[model samples]
Target: MRKFFDPNLAGANLKDRLLACLGALLGIGLTSVISAAFVHPHGAFLLIAAPMGAAAVLVFAVPASPLAQPWPVIGGNTVSALVGVAVRMLVPAPELAAPLAVGAAILVMSLTRSLHPPAGAVALTAIVSGPAVLDAGFAFVLIPIGVNSVILTLCGVLFHRFSGHSYPHRVAGIAPAPINAALQAEDLDKALADLGETLDVSREDLDLLFGRVEYHARHRRKGSTGGFPTGRAA
Candidate 1:
């Protein structure tokens, strides 16, 4: 049981772990407060808790994803909300409108590079929740949904930054993996073909995340095997 609870070297520092946990909690709490304060929705499903839970999962389980970041959380949800409202106004058939709204949300988010996972929830809420959401109208987009996103993102940025993780991570000065560099040098479509793996996430995202993991694993083995005087090297 003790062995199973061992920490990896890259994240072995106790303070860093504590900070990560704190940041995640703050992110969740801030969002929840804002969601409840405004844009008061009826069901527990479309409430702020949903997006906060989704964000918490992203922070802990999938921290490396671009989709997990602050911008994605805010922009993605807002864009989806707007799309939903537009679909409600424009499209006559929701059977057709629902899928289109979601697709439009995805397209806008991806193109704008703010692809948050919970945005799908906003779109789904817009279509399924029916008249309540429509009646709330633009207020739905502005008050609770948009308001919640901003508060959540602000919390995320502050928490991640103070916790020693980068927020709104700058791409500059960071060198991508050799494979990614090579891929980008070529066209994205062709590069994906060459990789020969079916990835659920974007190929570029997958590459960066895998590269980070591999790099950490290598150092973690060194720290555990070589640096730990209490343990014998296996």
Candidate 2:
């Protein structure tokens, strides 16, 4: 019970939480305004789906996460919407259609390397949004879903850039350190493969983390010794 209530589980500081709040506010506010302008004229239908809220959290709060990147935001949501529409059209039964839509969306996004978590909700929205969404047909994918994704992604990019965070982050692509170095690119890759599960972090980010850790360790050793440690003391 104590382990379950660990304070570490809370994670992130007030500043980070506030930044996420701001990002969600900007991303969703803009999306709602744009979506309402376009859709209100047609009829009363949701311009934005629920998933965009989750996407905003990733984009703003954890910009470095692979799932938060532009491709995941745009491609994942778009592809999932498409899959949802297709499933709804093919399966007449709501029970089968809903599950199939979510599962198929996951598979498609995984294959495309655009696996955003909120996209699964996008898939469900397409299935159960009533006739307004259904009448739009394939247009649903391009208009509200696709448009929403693109707009939010653009907003996230601009927000991250101005907020001192990198958007669409890329790996450092540093060459492997010498043989005597602590860890290498190949070693990291092997370790990842062995884990046999997806990680939110990218390889480059992991490498950078390792580099930072090594740097701090070296500095600490030197500081303790009043100079660089020599021989085995290193």
- Stretches off by above 4 angstroms in model 1 are 1-24, 39-49, 59-61, 170-193, 196-234
Top lDDT hit: 2
lDDT of each: 0.65, 0.79
lDDT of 1 by residue, 7-124 (tens): 5633355565566577767777767766665635544444563555676656543455567777787788888888988887788688988898889999999898888778877876
Q: What are the models' TM-scores?
A: 0.64, 0.85
Residue pairs clashing in model 2 are none
Lowest summed lDDT window (length 10), candidate 1: 225-234
Model 2, 162-231: lDDT tens digits are 7767888755434444222655568878988999998878777776666655556777867753432121
